[model samples]
Target chain A: MTILVKIFGDLRKKIEGYNISDALPLNLQIESNGIDTIADILNKFSIEKEETYHLFVNGTYSGYNKKVKDGDRVGLFPKNMSLLYKWYFERNEDE
Target chain B: MAKRILRVDMTKLEANFENFPADFAALGGRALTSTIVAKEVDPLCHPLGASNKLVFAPGLVTGTKAPTSGRISVGGKSPLTGGIKEANAGTTFAQKLGRMRIAAIVVEGKHEEDDYYLLKVTNDGTEFIKANKWSNKGLYDVYKELYKEFGDKVSISGVGIAAEIRGAASGICFNDPEGLPSRYAGRGGLGAVMASKGLKFIVVDETGAPGVEILNEEAFNMGVKKLTNALTSHDVTKPGGALNSYGTCVLVNIINEAGGLPQRNFSSGQDDRSEKVSGEVKAEEIKKRGGVRPHFCSPGCVIQCSEVWTKPGGKDPVGVLEFESVWALGPNCSIYDLDVIGELNRTCNDLGLDTIEAGDLLGVAMEGGLLEFGDGKGALKMLNEIKNKTPTGRILANGTAFTAQAFGVTRVPVVKGQGLPAYDPRAIKGIGVTYATTPQGADHTAGYAIATEIMGVGGTADPKDTNKSDLSRNLQLATAAIDAAGYCLFIAFAILDIPEGLEGVVDTLNGVLGASLTVNDVAGYGQQIIDTERAFNKAAGFTEKDDRLPEFFLKEPLPPHNEVFNVSDEELDKVWGT
Candidate 1:
């Protein structure tokens, strides 16, 4: 499964060897095994769970446990880049 | 130098200083402004008529060394919403008002003639100067001329051509740190209210003025220390933080990713082209072009999210393209180019138009077949029409709902006659609740639910859940308190997360008032402010039906999510238990 991962804010610099796409969503295509959750993807990129604040799976705010599928679009934002923290965190708890 | 109220009677052409009412000692910022407006102004009075009074008040801790506390609230019966309105901006003008020990400046009665006057305030006294010479000019040039004539040490608040014409979209402009007419109380058409009084500008010179009095110096210092620590230490507000690095526009990509960034006049939710105008791009452009990032709108703001956007090589500066401004002027119109957005923002600043309302107006104009979507030049031309005061421009200047009606656009996104800000209600349901229920009309800051949850003021509710009433109501209450305290809303992010930071806010208020106030009393104080506003709005004939999103928001499904605003009317009414 090919999952397109996008990094934003200060999180772009935190990832090793990831080319920072200036002013654009930094897109990194990773071959995922479909079984990999967002947390697994974070681990794969050496990004700590705490470092990632707002996680979106295919444009909908998702949790770390949400499993990735083929052609899934995942976005990760750092804690400092937090915009809608309540909605993201509270919505996740409900799910 | 006790706190006093400067009452300018435009009808009599006289200004007088009155002793501040002891009953209002605990009130400041939005609380004081709203309270004064409610008490004095008749609710059913025509918003742009002689009966409407404009009140400006600085926050309680504004002039003191409270980090990021420089804010001023402008309150009046809104020409846009036909309801009580309080719009605030962060500027040195607020600090000047605070330092001068002026609790509020009430401009009452309308000038009988068409002639405009400037109110010059100093430590000594107040004087009125005939300001007919500066009427109908762009604020950028006018600000420069005003600073030159009045000297560089003064803080100015003025109206532009839009206000002169009594446009409902007009906003009161204030000087930024660089003395650019960039900062604005830019919502609810307060500028028209100010202009209705035949007032063009209020220039405050605070030289030799006593600073804000701290009644309990020790407690004040301790509170200041705690707040400063929280602001500096928080990852979001600290130096090199997300805001400092990218400014508020950082939310462009984030909101876009969440499929909530309104695109092409709310026709869709997300667009790939939104990246072209993202904060990251703007920040990089600012760095390369010798523009300023991490700049403070007012002095002593630790979370300096403001930036100066200039042309290549930094020729002309349009102070700080905020997140809402960028989104409203950029993607909402399907114009993604930063340069075009910059010019549009500059024009809005110059013309004294709220960018959010103006953008929404242009969107409806395009939808009504007045122009093609993404026609940046066409948008500029329409703004020029406003500057020229053409009939078409006049229609557009009355704000989103009026423009939408004029153009026969049915998919109007507004609540209570005011234009909705950047967030689409269909996607961000919580903010939608705020947009619908807030007395201010579609203001996101009125109940920023994010900070509310973190502050633990409102117990949590799932965004997907229908019961977001508690979330919105609690947030509004807490926000009212913060607005009254005069701290920047950005401070809420830190204070909510850090318990000591929230306590710090209460401590500063107690220190200033020399009254004992605990953290538990924050919501109660906020409730009093909200109750005053609610009473005023109720007296103005606002009903539960007024607290509603447009029918289109409930009927039309936003893209990506393909979700309508499904929160029932009962749930929405339950927001205020109406």
Candidate 2:
């Protein structure tokens, strides 16, 4: 299955080969194995699911283990963007 | 000395100290200002007249070492909405007022003559000065001149030429941390109210004054510690949080992506060009230009989300370009250039106009075919009209709804006569309820349902939920209390999620006043403040009919999700009732 990953805020710098200045939600298409969760997808990208980052699947927040189907939209934000989203998520200080 | 009230009568050219009345002893900030205005000012009187009184008050916790508590509430009958108004700003003026043990400054009685005066205050006493030398000057120049005359230790609250011309959108400008006249109680035409009294500026010098008296020093310290911990730990209010990194304009992308960004005068929701003026770009630009990204508007602000945006080569520093200001001047006006937006924002500060209202007016003017969309130069030209007081400028200065009416355009997005801020009510239903039902008239801060509806501050509510009146009500009640405490509204980001932070707020108030106020009492206190403002509005002839969004919000379906404001009128009425 193939899914779209959008990185926003400071994490945009982490998305290799993406221009941080070129608009926002720096997009990249990722091919994934069957029924991959958000965590699995980030793992594939070599992106650690750090405590500072918030994951949003489609417009709502999604946990790392939440399953993603084909063409699922995912947004990853740093601590700053997570704070900006004001999305209610427990902070995992162990990051 | 007991807390005092300074009454300045422009008509008599006299400044005198009056004993703080016992009835207002417990009241502070908006709670005191609204109570005084409701009791003294005639509701039906013209807002920019002698019958209307302008009140300045620091919140109960203002002068203490309380983090982000340096907010001042300026209240009066609004010339913009013709209703009770309290617009707040983060400035050292409030800290000075609080340290001096001055509960409130009530400016009443219009000047019979055509001269302007400045009210200067020190710990010793207050004096009125003839300010004719700085007449008709922009606040930037006025602040610089006043700074030179009084030294940098003084805090200034002044008006620009727009206020002198009685522009309905004019707001009282205050000096920021850098002594620039940028921070403002920038809503409801309170500057016009001040200018109507023939007062040009207020200088507060708190040197040699004892700081605010804390009744329970230990309790206050504990409370401050708790709040500070919560603020520093929270992802939002932390030192290097999103707000600190990029300022409030960070929301430009989030809201734009949600299809609720209100573009080109609410004609559309999403604008691809929005990212050009967004926080991501803004932060990058500020860094590239060697500007201060994480700046404080006032002293003791833990959440330094404010910024000082300097021009290329770090030459001229512009004031903070807030998210709403960016939205108003950028996406809403279809002008995507940050440079243009910053210029327009500076014009608003210089002219003492509300940036939100000024931006809304430009959009409305565009909708009325006065300017072309995306024409940044044209928008600047329109603002120049207000500065130059051209006939067109005069009409535009009155604000969005009035400009729409003058142009015979019916698609004005306003409630209770004040223009809507950045949010589109149709796409975000919870805030729509707030925009409709709040006493302050289309004000987003009045009941920022966006916190929950979009940002998930307190609890995530479906933005499209009409039954979330309970959420709006709870937030509104708590917000009133926060406003009364003189804490910056940003503190809500921490306190709403961290229960201890809210308790800390209550503790600070209790320690300040020597009262046994529980956390539960906050809601009730907020309710009382709202009830007071509502009663004033009702007395001023507002009805259930007045607590409504413009007709187009209900009738027109916004794009993307194609949602209309689905909240029933009954649900909106239930906001105050509950």
Candidate 3:
């Protein structure tokens, strides 16, 4: 099963000519043969599973190691000044 | 001869002028207020009680040749957050007062009766005037009436209807060039405490007064030129034009694009309706209406980031509606109409309230079905109640944390009863640290972690990387120090790119005070200020547990972003690592 990976913001700038609305069309070409676990998904971008990155799967929140299903729109995000969605996980360090 | 502090003992109906404290001479802004409050005011006292005090201290550069330094801070035990809050705003009147050699003014004690009064601080002396004619008025009207009597040139700080009602989200409004009462120490509800003291307004008249004297004119000139040049040359400060136009609202699309924009109250990162409320759209509206953008907050400001927005098609600006307020109220609450948002923003400004906290509560209310999502008119109605003192007004006026508690909503985005700003912890992990760590209670400016990711000002932190804990800590400390100086935080964008920008500010300070304060001194001062606030919070019954975010952050996963609040409390404990 191929999981959908969506890159955005400055990270998106690293790629060429990717529009925001159509991020999935660009993700369909990812081969599912070698990478299957959530850890493998992060490794593609020099990331680690416990690296404090906000993980997103589809339109709902998911847990780490949750099997990435076919066509899962996974968005990787960085921290921001305008923190709008942070209440979903409050167990983190207050700093 | 500098004007002395105007000290008032409201209970005794006595007032007097006191010389500046020897230790406070070198301190200004947060340095002065926090120092004075920590030493003099009892931190453990009830925020609204007589033991609590309000200290108004301008930035060190304020009234001096430094540009955009006319900002002032009002420090006290915040009724909203129940923490030490140092609220800030740009006031031209503040600069005029500072020009008269007044470093700060303190208001203490509770009034004997329910009668409200006004405080007038002029070059001659301080006096308490009868405020019977202006009771129950919003800050805009309050300033208008006072402005007429004060000859329109005086600096004024006052509370609004919400403040008079003693709500926690209440703030204090100061005068701007346009005199709309648009600027505020708009966080943590210090205004309510002032109102509790039976003081509605503080008028400072500096007409025909000499501005603050720079100890060394030559060094000051060099420092000012280099600083202004460094600021103007940076991309964010120079080319972005975001500051001059939409102010911080320009970050809406950028953060949304980064997949970090908290939508519908931490449920998702994208709201879709964000476009209709983007900074570009606001700029277009203001442009079409001949509205002014990038207006200075105070005199001598080189980086004019404040906007003078008019009612869409009108000539006079209704008020300032920034990025934080726009996101907090519009998408967070699922409301989209910019006009209605503007009305809500204006109402908040007049009420001397924190727009961020109020919007978060509105979101919670929407989740609980008290108000429907996307009902812009509904938000307008609820905000209208605040000024009128309805039950709903009382609930919403207290801030997001309290409102969420009252409504039994568990998915609250708050810290110490203060509403979280526009970032979601599940999406942007570093900003989560900032929201968690800031002494100011869930404020972004305390540590704007996004400056690295979205703004590209600092070393790019993978907003997705867990390593941001250390990164966020450094930024938070740096930001705390900057806030202490009362310098505009937007300067971070410039200093992040040009290190000299930071030097210019410090050099200017050294020249003024005849001190050899280095950049390290400034950074250390930030940590010191945080330490002071922590000591205050510790005395006020807060512990390591109060520092944590709301519990819902641990249970709920933000949609489209599967991130959890994974930073361990131990990791947080290590943030202020020695």
TM-score winner among the candidates? 1
Q: Rank the candidates by lDDT, best first.
A: 1, 2, 3
Query: Please, what are the lDDT tens digits per residue for candidate 1 over residues B200-272?
Result: 9999999899999989987898899998998898888899988888999988988888888899889888998
Better of 2 and 3 by DockQ: 2
Inter-residue clash pairs, candidate 2: none
- Native-referenced TM-scores of chain A, all candidate models: 0.80, 0.74, 0.56
Instruction: List the candidate numbers ranked by TM-score, top first.
Output: 1, 2, 3
RMSD of 2: 3.7
- RMSD to native for every prediction? 1.6, 3.7, 6.8
DockQ of 3: 0.06
What DockQ does each candidate score versus the true complex, computed on alpha carbons? Answer: 0.56, 0.27, 0.06
Using lDDT as the measure, name the better of candidate 1 and candidate 3. Answer: 1
Encode model 3's per-residue lDDT on B1-578: one tens digit a residue: 75467677888767787888776667788777777788777877888999988888887777777755677878988888777888888787667657877777778899979899888877777788989788777677777877788886677888888888899988888878877888878889898989988888888888667778678777677778777887787645553344654467766764664456787877887755676787657766776778777667776776676676677566546666788888987888777777878877887887777788888888988887788888888887888888788998898888887787888888888887788887777666666777777777887777741133322234444433456656676676666666655577777766665767777877888777777887666545666888888888888888777767777777777665566777777766666652
Best by lDDT: 1
lDDT digits (tens) for residues A1-95 of candidate 2: 67887777877776678776664567777786654687777776667767435666654445677777788777676666654323222222111
What is the per-candidate TM-score for chain B? Answer: 0.98, 0.97, 0.95
> What TM-score, over all chains together, does every model reach?
0.98, 0.93, 0.84
Off by over 4 Å in 2: A1-4, A18-24, A31-43, A46-74, A83-95, B449-466
Kindly provide the TM-score of model 2 when superposed on the true structure, using C-alpha atoms: 0.93
